[model samples]
Target: MHKDRIWNKWLFKVIGLELVKCCAEFAASVDFKRDYLKILLSDYLPESDPLKKWFNEGLKIGLEKVAFILNNDNQLVKISDIIIDEVGLLTRNIIPNQYIKEFVCTNYSLPGITEQNVLQIFPGSEKLKHYGAKTLSQSDLKKISSVRPFSF
Candidate 1:
């Protein structure tokens, strides 16, 4: 049982690191497809894993950001609707609580991230309560006021 716990922790860590790398690369590229992340995640995790739920939530948030960046408010709304529908509003709210808490507790070191700058990179706890798990942050929300295509 102890060994299993250790293995699971290691697995989550590996998956988390890979997901972050993939998300960054996908976000920066012009050719990113919305389903590409789903496919990649499915390859790494089983369908019923709770971690998959959290990762998918992150993917949805990223997609919303992309839609906002492309000036497609309609698509953003659709994405948000899909999230609320798939997870239900309540579960959607709870999902982010565990997700963000685990993320911070794991102490996954990102480049240039430190105690001093962590809040700047990721919103502080108080700010997180405002954004919750459903959205990214205020700046992200502001950017999404308009939406556009994925074209560079």
Candidate 2:
């Protein structure tokens, strides 16, 4: 039951290239054969493209922060080129993890205003209201850490 394996091709391709190099390096321990070629084509291709580099880097950051839940050497995460190509218009390529989480939660909490440029141009619109942008004062944001448990 493989449900549309997206990154497997790239992974296999990578694996094949390594195997080829490995066999060449240690020819005594390995033999090149037609059956191996079948496994090579089926399992891996050398020039497979990967997800976007920036997004991959971002995932690497997260994996590091969380005690290396994943192998950073392997691009386990999938970032489509379509999305990468659409960066800046739809998203920034170099956002940090805190910014990413904040973006997700803030947007999910208010569908009207999540990274949309509604607030910059149209200040007090309904979308801005949903985002609570008006209420979020510079002072309040700056002093969020200093505010007491029940302080006003």
As for model 1, its CA RMSD to the true structure in angstroms is 16.4
- Taken over the whole model, the C-alpha lDDT of each candidate is 0.34, 0.28
CA RMSD, predictions in order: 16.4, 18.8
Q: Model 1: per-residue lDDT, tens digit, 34-144?
A: 422332332324437655544455544444343221112212211222111122212334333334333333333222222222222121223222222223343432333
Q: List the pairs of residues colliding in candidate 2.
A: 12-44, 13-44, 13-45
Evaluated at residue 30, the lDDT of candidate 2 is 32
Off by over 4 Å in 2: 1-3, 28-152
Put down candidate 2 lDDT per residue, 13-124, tens digits, no spaces.
Answer: 3443454333223322335321221221221112233433322333333222322101122212211100111123223323332443344345334323333221122211
Clashes of 2: 3
